[model samples]
Target: MTLIAERVRELTGARQPFVHATVVRAQAPTSAMPGDDAVILADGSIEGFVGGVCAETSVRAAALDTLRDGNTMLLRVLPDGAASFPDAPGAQVVVNPCLSGGAIEIFLRPMLPRPLIGVAGATTPIGAAVVTLAGFLDLEITEPMAYAGASAVVVAGLGRDDEQVIRAALDAGVPLISLVASRTRGAAVLDSLGLTAEERARVRPHAGIDIGARTHQEIALSVLAEIVRELRASSPEPVAAAPTRTAIDPICGMTVVIGEGTPHAVVDGVEHWFCCAGCRDRFVAAS
Candidate 1:
């Protein structure tokens, strides 16, 4: 159990998603006892045993489901030939095919990572934004090159190399890129970039929830709020026709549009989009 806990920490720190399964209850004839735990990797492999081979299959299926839904589930596995039992509230039932007339109940929980937000620029607004965002999200405070794995990137340089930073994020195919500048200044910078009209539309100006933010902290909060909205939206529209705005799905490594109805998973709180259900299933199975 101690080793399982340590592995969980290590995987989460590395921003990987995994399922933890624990046997909470067991009936006579079962090979597993209460308190037995195991870590299920993404490839449908188990690091520990909750029961014999039959019970393992049920547990792995439940773990994959929990990972996909980002929810905790109580799984009750009844032995072959046994009468099905009533499911508790929010618990799922699985009928094992093994000959052993034993029942096992396992609880599955998935640990996902928070989204990583990259704040570029050394300006006061950028610094304040990074500090303020620390309480709400995982932050990566660095230049555009450091945004390689960031879920979203925000430029708050207040005109200092804003174009360069924005270009870098765009070039890297970041899903969300916002500029913390006034409308006029943002438009001027965009114009200077010589981007086509369609490309310019992909860049959000005055990036924030419009609450009339004037101070640095307030602006930062507003920006963070907008980011939350983006993360939680059920169907977000894809950015306008920007050639550079293409995201690669981590699950299958396929390039996908960062748009509405795109299948994605939040691993260790970081968002990882998928190209299709098969890929998503594979990812969860392997995780």
Candidate 2:
């Protein structure tokens, strides 16, 4: 038997998925029978039991071919039977025709990439946005002791002790890291850490949109809206474009983006815009 679990973890860290070939069923005469195991890495490398030179040779070659693209397959090798490089979901591994005589069955599974994110805060908005962004992306959200795949990480306490956390994140090669703070505070935190200007600039801070947020939940909404905005900026997936300007929904405190030329009336030094009559009614009633 092979240390399959460790290898799987390693392959996953490398963002490479491989095929899990197991000798589920076997027939007599062959030295290698059912219950044998082999890890077919994305690179087409095999670790574990080798059934036969002929079978191993062909499977290794086919596995590499599979790595170029993500395709799960199951192969059956017979004492003389051949191997087929089929697709996942229904593919089979047949490596039985080895000089050994027994037939071998191997299963192949493919792995794919995930979106990785490093968040600065996890309290409210940042946490929600990360969970949402991971809707399909590889998300790694990390906190003091929490680690979510390559989601978003919230730098709630961005200070000296936090240096390693940030540095480690960079070392881990996460795709994105967001800092939740005002520009001045963000600068101060970075400066205290003696980070290079370039490093400071690399952080996407300021949390999210500035829509008169006064509560933790509201702050989170603003940040999430900002993240969604950034995501929509380039995503091929369809999403409603946020209005360039948004007014706080006084009743619920939700930032309601108003389309251009929408009706608005100013009062108390702050402008209020509404997306619908109901919202407008609530805003007016709240006033």
Candidate 3:
């Protein structure tokens, strides 16, 4: 377990957090055989063996907490209903990792979120892929004028049919692209489109999966898996993410958060925040 902590520190980028679970005590007559230990990887895989099914489930949930809080906790579970925890922000969900005959206490901790996946090709399914994998939205490539949001661009078969897809995404400095095809086929497609060798080099071809992934569903799964792996490998620390709320300027329809030192107007019952001076002026006038 200590080695796992060192491993997290050693990796410059780790997307998922690692958690250590050590079973402290097991009852002699009961199901839990003492001294069991486990390590929960970023991808929700356990390395060591615990006691029974109940113990495993309880510990798995606790490990996820490590990812969110980036802290370590000692979880002590008694022979059912014997243990209880005090209320704290995101810290009350501990359960005794011991089941049956004895009680067990374990430590759980998480590392960081080092996952960023770049997806390309058509990009319509990219959104669905994002939902499926809990991944960072790298980019989406599609025909010209199509817009939503993407960390990078995902492209379809290359041609004049979709020149803007490449041009705009590139101009925006999207670092990764996941194209679907063989290397030769991809090169031919780019050549036909008059893409310079430099331009072509900027585009990543033949996404994370191999060429043989024939079905759309299978391809999506494969690509998603690759993205998750990449994110895990790239991130040095995986931290739990929390929702952020921006103060909305009632007078101007602008949103701002605390860190953003934007001009604000107190609108009687509400305090409004703005992105710039002009918006603040307009807001004051409207009010």
- What TM-score, over all chains together, does every model reach? 0.73, 0.43, 0.34
- Model 3: how far is 91 from its true place, Å? 8.5
- What global local distance difference test value does model 1 have? 0.70
Can you write out model 2's per-residue Cα lDDT over 1-287, one digit (the tens) per residue? 24876776786677555666665554564456666777765444568774654455446544554555456566665444433323346554443222345555565555544444455444455455545554544443444533434534445443434556565555554434556677887666566666556666545656667899876656656665665566556453121222234455453343343444343556687777643455556566667
The residue-by-residue lDDT of candidate 3 on 1-287, one tens digit each, is 55544555554243335676766555554455556566776444566666554455456656765666567776654554554433334433433323444555565655444333333343455435533444344322333433332333445443333445566555655544455556786666556667666677656565556646666655665665555555456553345433334555454333333233346677777776654556678778777
The 0-to-1 C-alpha lDDT of every candidate, in the order given, reads: 0.70, 0.53, 0.52
Q: Residue 37 lDDT in model 1? A: 88
> Which ranges of candidate 1 are over 4 A from the true structure?
81-87, 122-126, 138-144, 196-198, 234-287
Rank the candidate models, highest lDDT first. 1, 2, 3
- Give per-residue CA lDDT, model 1, range 4-82, as digits (tens): 7888888878767678899988888888999988987655567877987556656766676666667788999886568
- Top model by lDDT, which number? 1
Q: Can you tell me which runs of candidate 3 are displaced by over 4 Å?
A: 1-149, 157-162, 191-202, 236-287
Q: What would the TM-score be for candidate 2 when compared with the true structure?
A: 0.43
Error of 3 at 32 (Å): 35
Locate the minimum summed-lDDT window of 10 residues in model 1: 236-245
Q: Using alpha carbons, what is the TM-score of model 1?
A: 0.73
